[model samples]
Target: MNNPNQFIPTPYTNSVDSGNFTWSAPSNIALVKYWGKREPQIPANPSISFTLNKCKTITTLSFERKRHGGFSFDLLFEGQPKESFKPKILKFFERIESYLPFLTDFHFTIDTRNTFPHSSGIASSASGMAALSMTLMSVERLLNPEMTDDFFYQKASFLARLGSGSACRSIKGNLVVWGEHEDIPQSSDLFGVEFPFEAHEVFQNYRDTILIVEEGQKSVSSTVGHDLMNGNPFSEARFAQARTNLTRLKQILIDGDLKSFVALVESEALSLHAVMLTSNPYYILMKPNTLAIIEKIRKFRSDTNVPICFTLDAGANVHVLYPDEYKGVIKTFIDGVLSLFCEGGKYIEDKIGNGSELLTVNS
Candidate 1:
């Protein structure tokens, strides 16, 4: 428990004092899907996730210490300046100040880098918010050391959620489930079991392979997706499925059965999007070639009997799940699949990851 990044700086009460901090947060893939939210800040249905072993964003933030105004950001998506995100950036910082109240009135030069391709269906938000959260906490500690851990994660997730829904899960360690989701908080109350569904060791081995079916960004934002879900006739049923999926999948994870887990994961992801399709307008996240990849995977499984399967978020990407032992077989299949895709088909090797660590804290 050494504090490598620990700081012992004199506390400053002024928000205008400029300073900088660097941090990183790993990406995560949902195992038990959360498709909607009561407060976009909090999930409407409980979801469990594995903080990825691969894919994350690193951010170096320098504050304009003497200036006092609403937060200003320099957002670099995939190393390119994208000013269109400026409004969202300003609003996100405002939301943080509104809730935390301690982070208002600062201008920041934010430099962000993603280890994975942002447009290649990788989850950039999970890692991005995580980096944001960690850096903010570091900055907060320098300015105010009296903050509590309870408020730390909740506020982190809440702030990050404005950027993306999956951001909420990045605040915790490897396996984190937002208890705010179900009527039953994921904290406990797993059918009165001695241990909750998310606490098992079997889930530690759970990993995902994100296949970018369509490289372009999604047409439906998560916020928009939730609204669409709300309008769907099956929204209620879909939510119930989320709760049930979490419960059942937790047990399957504990049992460490690859086949059952894959089936459940694939089904849950499909069902989440199916609700989207059932919306009055009936939109689909799947691209034309997305299904071709699925069919390829399905056929590969049929031929090789490899323990592998696919899942999707509201985007045209697929998260393939497999045991650590069969990584070669799954990887080879991916190689073939990518060979058929456009310019970017490369996959990153990822596993469940621990949250942010202070790489360095200047004295």
Candidate 2:
């Protein structure tokens, strides 16, 4: 048999039968949003994102040799068994099994918990799937032991993309780029690569305060929305625009041009929604409060010149991004002006992160 590790050019051997490993992976907020995709979870456009610190998922996988030799696993969310999550996990395993033949040799028990609520405008799938990918990579290393960090992360990102396209970006810290572009030599639609350029300190440590405009499930799932892009009148233009914006945003990040950053980020957010409106059999994901939050943010920016901006992720919630210097001022504004529009006046305080981490391993 060809060495699977070298074949994909990707893992180790472990004697212990029953063992556990855990990883904490942060969710990423795309500055240049990934609105559309191709088959097998490929991004239709190049996108970049800030990997957020406080919004993350911690997942632990317990593994034992399967007596009968078939793939099997159990999932728990927040310490409780969540049957609703099993089907998706099964489907994900089915999709990636070819790349990970060892999966059929073990039975896994996965426990996952998030700092933020599920289906509440956070990229739960991104963090969740990324964490799972890390655990699987850890196991692969334990079994094969020959891979380098580059191969490990590349394969992990590749596996994560198979689960959720955005999850691929969550594997790295600070800024990450996904999807191929002429300007970016190594970028690919199949997996994300870390943003190659050094970013200005101001943009590197930016804060993302999530304004919970609606703390409920989106009316249209991101999957459905992506599928609708098949015949979207603006699909071609949007893809081209994303490529162009990614190039511009990279320069802005390096130059520390907050003005252009704000304009581009906000426009990208709005343009994402605009595409939904102009799609065939149109639908709207932004709620009344979502608009209110945007208006309040714009007014706040104009009034105070705090260099703050907003972005959204196919939902009503607003992510108010700004420099750390504006934390006190922005918090005051959130309390006095923006809180009313949020669901139960809820919001999450987050910042650029240090990427995914392996928490523990028990053998």
The Cα RMSD in angstroms, rounded to one decimal, for candidate 1 relative to the true structure is 5.6
Model 1, runs deviating above 4 Å = 1-16, 76-81, 148-151, 181-202, 341-344
Q: Compare the candidates by TM-score and give the number of the best one.
A: 2
Give the TM-scores of the predictions, in the order they appear: 0.84, 0.96
- Model 1 TM-score relative to the real fold: 0.84
lDDT of 2 by residue, 183-241 (tens): 76678777778888889989767999998888767888889899989999889999899
Q: Show the colliding residue pairs in model 1.
A: 16-65, 17-65, 18-65, 53-351, 179-186
Candidate 1 lDDT score at position 87: 76
Best by lDDT: 2
Report lDDT (Cα) of residue 185, candidate 2.
62
Cα lDDT tens digits, model 1, 1-363, are 112112222345634366778777777788778776655355667787777765878888776553464455677665688787677667666655644444555566677888887787677767787677777766776566566765455555555665676776776667676643343343521101112444446456756777666776788777777777667778888878888887787667667777787788889878877888888777788876677777887888889888788878778877777767777777777787644653365556677776655565542
